[model samples]
Each structure stands twice: as structure tokens, then as C-alpha cells.
Target: MITQEKYRTTVKELLANGTIKMAIGYRPGSTPDRRRPLFIRTSEEADQLVLDSTCITNLSGYLVTEGLLSDEKQVGIFLRPEGIRSINILAAEYQLNVDQIVIFGFDSTGREVRPLQGRNAGDFSALLTEIKENPPLTSKEPLLERVEKMNAKERFDFWQEEFSRCIKCYACRQACPMCYCRRCIVDSNQPQWINTSSHTLGNFEWNVVRAFHLSGRCVQCGNCDRACPVNIPLRLINQRMAKEVVDGFDHFAGLSPTQEPVLASFKKDDTETFIL
Candidate 1:
């Protein structure tokens, strides 16, 4: 609650001084445990801001809305550490300019929400490095362990059963910050890449293609997992892919705005274990 009040005051000050044209934060939702995005452009709107442990949705995606930053005015946004990494990825891809953003970073443990001491993405370099060295325990949970221990055929069956439930709603893609493609291949008819219907085979192809696209770029924010209406374990697939890149290339996604994408760039000594 103290942190919440501090940010409200900060937003009000920034707006009063014309430091930012808008601020994106959270507000109470329909339920006690839910939160919705609040766009603050005035002092009265700043009063509606809510910052707490439940404010976990990555609000960075809203930064890419068309024409929002065309005027080049700064926009302040509430972000978690993962959200900061996302902006780095977006900047690296030329999706948005980091200079136009002012970060209000925060993270939480249990019910305690604490402010992170940084206003720009570059200011959090050391902290991001620390996170890359020691990732969160959620990445190594028992479910991922069980999937990793499965034989090839067992693993195929496992994911097949999960993919069978997909309804092709694309909620996972919509929720992901990394899926910024203006015209996704699934929607393309030029060459007709994958089956567009919601059959199990189509579902498998869609999910696989999306996972492959995010191989080395996912921040594991769990937005896709939470947004899946059918409750597919989308995080497991992305986490497995992220681990593969780190082990094979020593690459951690979103370390900086200029970091080369792991799969996009090639090196002479790149691992070729699967070449057989």
C-alpha cells in the first residue's frame, strides 16, 4: 500500500510537470484479486492507480499501440522485471523506441510489493544480469522435470494430449509480448503455411510454429499461459525452448536493447548436435 501511494504521487508529479503525457498502471478489477490496466493522463486518473502483488500482467505490450508514441512524448509505465526485459526485446527488434518510455519498475514476493530503483531500461542492467545468472524457481518445477524425463515417444504423446484441447482462439498469441508480428503466418494465405481450422493437427502446427518463433526470445512472463482459455501449458514449451538456447548458445533473451537475437544471428562455432 505504501508503494502504491508513492507511485500515485510520482505519477501526479510527472503529469503536473509535463514530464510524461500518459502513465499506464493497474486498477482494481471486477474481483478482489484481479486488476485492469489504467491509463492516466490527469491528476484525477492518477488517484485510481493500484499497485500490488496481483498486478502481474505485462503492460509493456500496450506501449506498441499504433500512433501512441508518434508525437514522441514520454509515457510512464508500471513494469515488472520481466516487463523491462520485454521492452529491451521490442527495442532490439525495432518495434518501439526505449527513449520514449519511463519505467516504474516493481516486483513482489508473496503479498509484498516492492519498488525497483530504476526509471530507464539501461539503469537495470546489473539487475537483469543477476536474474539471468539465477532464474526463478518456477522455471524448474516438477511438471517441467516430468516432461524432461519422458522418452521421445512419451513426450510426443504428452504434448499431443495437451494440444488436443486447443480451440485455435489465439489467446496465447494475443497475450504474449513477443508476438508482435503484424500479419502472423497462421493468418497468411499466400502460401498457406498451416491449417487454419481448430482440429488437433492444426492446433499442433499452430502451437509449434508459435513456439519456434519465440525459441530464443521468450521472457517467460506466463501471459500466454494465463490467457489460454483451454488451460494449455504453453509456458512449459517456451521454457523448454529457452533452456535449449541457453544451454546450446549461452544466450539469455532481453539482456539489452542491442543484444543480437540468438537464432537470427549465426556463428562459425554454433552447436550442430542435431545435424545428424
Candidate 2:
């Protein structure tokens, strides 16, 4: 397990050596057990760096914020395995140059903080490959299973009930790293694609559009799920769409920096069963 002292030493050295202009890591939050994102600008601030199971916010989301990387200078970020994968997806989508980012990778295996070997996201290709080959055990959520067992009409009613509670706060979108659009379709009042209100129909449209937009791009980090205040099962919808993309397009999201987005690329050899 990597201690906080060791983590701070590494960050301090990086900042002092000018390897990175800023270091995005974690610090103790308001609650004792909670951790929040911490930005380190100087070596003196490095002592605040912390790495543990509580450091679970996908820090890669910060990489693409407007004006955050505008300087085009190198920035260091503390990343878990999923955050590394998000970097790959970001690179693949041409959101940022991979070389401009340095990854201080770490993973919490049970209670131990294990440092990952990688300077950049691509360096962890083998680790990602291993994850792909031997996927993690997904404990079945009874609620998801129950929804899956329902008939189409019953499932619709279930989601409608769930979405009805949405306040249209857009917290889910704001938390998602992939929902980086400057102007979401719902926000287009000139020709509103989706209702901006939080009524039942509007909520349904908002959630469906959100899920579809994330179909082939979602990293499955459950950021949206965690961000939703109403406890909507956003992960289940994302998982179902992810499985459909895998079965239909034979593509998985966020595996490599060079891999093209599943929906953006086309080949002549591609099948068109839905084209009639």
C-alpha cells in the first residue's frame, strides 16, 4: 500500500521539477471518510495529496473542462484504471493530445493502494487488455434483474416512474465526462429537440436521449448514476446499451486511444440488417 507521505513526495518532486504545471489529485473532504478532488499548483501544496478507496471520482473528467487545458501545457493527473480508460476515450475522440497529460496511476485493490506503472494512458494497454480478457465480477443488482424480467410495457412504466422524479437539474450531464457538449440538444430553444421542462414526457425524453448519446461512448464509471439525486438507475440503462453495442457493432468503449468511436467510423464490409 502506498502511504500518503510517499504520494506527496512524488507530487512535490513533479511540481518542483516543472514536470507538470498542475497536479489533479484528492484531499480529505468535509466528512472523515469522504475525499474530494484537490488541485496542487505548488510543491508546498503537495502534502494534501491522498490516494485511497475514497479517491474514486474519475479525475479524467477534469481534463476536458473548458479553459482547464487551454494553456496546451502538460498537466499531471492521478488516475485509477477507469480514469485511464477515460483518457484513452478522450484521446481517441481527439479531445486532447495524450502527450500533454501525465498520469500518476494508482488503484485501490481492496484496502491497499497499489501504484500502477504508466506514464501515459497508452502505457497501460496491457493492463486494459488483461481487464478485457478477464472482466471483473459484476454482482447482479436485484433491481436491474427485476426490470429485465419485466415485459416491455412493464419496463416502460418502471422507467417512467423512475424518470418522473427527475428535477431536470442536469447534474447527471454535468458529472459525465463524455457529456462535454457546449450546447446540448435540450438546450436548443430555437428548435427544441427535447422539452426543457421536468414533466413526465420531458423527463422520459431527457433520460432516453442521455442514454442514447452515451451508448457507444460511456466508460461505465457510474458518474451519472452517482450524480443523480433521485437515485435513478442510470447504470442499468447504460449497461443495456453497452451490451447492445457490443452485440451489434462488436465494439467496446474506452479500450484504446487509437480506436475510433464505434458510431463515427464506417466500413464497406459492415452489415446493414436494419436498412431493409
Clash number for each model: 0, 0
The residue-by-residue lDDT of candidate 1 on 1-276, one tens digit each, is 999999999999999999999999999999999999999999999999999999999988899888899999999999999999999999998888899999999999999999999898899999999999999888548999999899999999999999999999999989998988889999999899999998888999999999999999999999999899999999998999999999989989999988898878988998787898
> What local lDDT score does residue 169 receive in model 2, on the 0 to 100 scale?
97
Query: For model 2, what is the alpha-carbon lDDT of residue 11?
Result: 79
Model 1: residue 90 alpha-carbon error in angstroms = 0.3
| Per-candidate local distance difference test | 0.93, 0.85
Task: State which candidate has the highest lDDT.
Answer: 1
Compared to the true structure, candidate 1 yields what TM-score?
0.98
Tens digits of per-residue lDDT, candidate 2, 97-172, equal 8998999988876778878897887899999888767656543357667888999999989999999999999999
Best by TM-score: 1
Clash pairs, model 2 backbone: none
